[model samples]
Target: MPSGGSTLNAENSGNHTLPSTLAGVDPLSQFLTGPRAQAAFTLRVTMDPPFAIDVQDQAALTVIAAIQGGAWIIAAGTDPQFLAAGQAATVRGPAPYVVADAPDRAATVVIGPGQSCRTPAGDHVDVTMSHGVRSWGNSPDGDTVLLIGTYQSSAAAGQLAVSALPPLAVFDTQETDPALLGLIEREMSRPAPGQESALDRALDLLLLHLVRASVDRADAAGPSWATGTRDPVVARALEVLHAEPASAWTVAELAKRAHVSRATMASRFQAAVGQPPMTYLAAWRLALAADRLASSTATTAAIAQDVGYSSAFAFSAAFSRAYGVSPTGYRRAAEVS
Candidate 1:
């Protein structure tokens, strides 16, 4: 497939609701609906064979999917993984890595701040070949086509999502919703009005699909959060926790909600979530508060109340303890960055 052949199209069949167990546990939904994710950064890269690019240490999570030929991903401290056409990979960063036709190929350029690229010797390497909208690379007719979706915010909720993932994860396109990818590809090449907004939504959907597919692989060894969603009792309790983060939930109350004995619920929740009920709830509330701080214009007191805290002082203390920064300070830093 040629790079220029990719076209942006309107309308798609990818719009769908969340799964039953995952309905209220919509982690991706929360991430996307939050302020930072709304401004998601994305790119469409086109390249010929014998190509390789390295991205330096960046505290961002990237979703890379191929649309044309194949490529190989080599993240620091991990083995090289190959990605065929239609396949996708998530590269968790704060570390450097390389993407190329093969593992042996050295990086020809380094991607830096603002997605700028330069030769290893520090000479600027301009991506003069632009194929379609938001697209750039070595050639406009490059054989290898890639869609890159990035989530670079350091917000607490965003970090929580990254914490549940392995440093490098891959899944086949067959496991993804075809329509979502189709919509992403179609929208990537159009400079139409509100295109950035459209791309943000599409990228979020694609990330959700890829992450869910990775977690749902038949192999049982997966994150406790993902595996817990499969257990009826634990799933129910999780749904409650997610649905009502401000409910001031207690262990017994959550157990009643899950329709199980306190002891039984405690044991199972521990096994499935790797944490006790109250402990999990505390973490969840803090995460919600963090997202509210970064994404909303609500007052500290209001945000605190929304996440179960009745006293603004108590919320500030807890928020500071968990994040080492006051809520206002955290919001300020996020805004500055």
Candidate 2:
């Protein structure tokens, strides 16, 4: 009953068209496509005043959009930011933060790892406070309403983009599209087959839009990887690297692809991207491999070959040097976490 003109329930979803794959050649699109959501955690929350939730879930990324009233996001050391109706904020995580009606309000609920909910006094509250399907809050008809989407497994691929953002990036009402927000809100509440996948794609689209908005801002403080996309030459080269991380790329080859000379490509790339092309490629490949290692059952050799490494041994050495852990150890740690 949202913008798409069909209920997301499975009974009607068969006739509902899935969104087209994001096929843009830009850096953000490429980054998102590689390690997009598989089964994201999304919820609608309603609350009243004098409420705060202490968040320590260590999720990779979270998008919090205000659907009704407003709330304050308080990350350590940074001043609290407010999200009024139709506004949104993205929180890059693994770090703990808090959300409340007022910046000074104490948290009454604590969200722990794996989204376990408890009180500050350590009594579990998830089941006790449940509202209904994919919804949770202190009050059923509270003045404030929020939609929260968390990306848990996309951390490795998202690091390049997230690193460029501050702990929180707030979007004012004018910057956010109301129709898109409504679509997400509607799809999230539907009890339909493939609903998880529907929400996953929707959340990915929202994140892509937010990254684009952040980069387009005149006062954006994002790193070279984000800001560099504005340059045609650097952007083309980035597209090449991200699109073909497994390709055996050289500076001359990259320059040729970007329609620039080798020397020109090298200088401009360094100035704009903050690293040599090969170095960036290596990091990208490793990031891809790391995510695969965590999320799939692929063998190290298979993953190595897939990401352009000559052999598992070579990949292991490079991965260890960069991540400070062997691939096996990294997988073990990921499983434990």
Highest lDDT among the candidates is held by which one?
2
Each prediction's TM-score against the native? 0.86, 0.83
Worst 10 residues of 2 by lDDT: 5-14
Residue-by-residue lDDT tens digits, candidate 2, 36-111 = 6666788888898889999998877888999999999999867899989999898987788898999999889999
Instruction: Provide the global lDDT of candidate 1 against the true structure.
Output: 0.71
Q: Which lDDT value does model 2 have at 175?
A: 80
RMSD of each: 7.7, 8.8
> lDDT of each prediction vs. the true structure?
0.71, 0.76
Q: After superposition, how far is residue 5 of candidate 2 from its true place, in Å?
A: 25
Q: What's the CA RMSD of model 1 in angstroms?
A: 7.7
Candidate 1: clashing pairs of residues: 8-186, 9-186
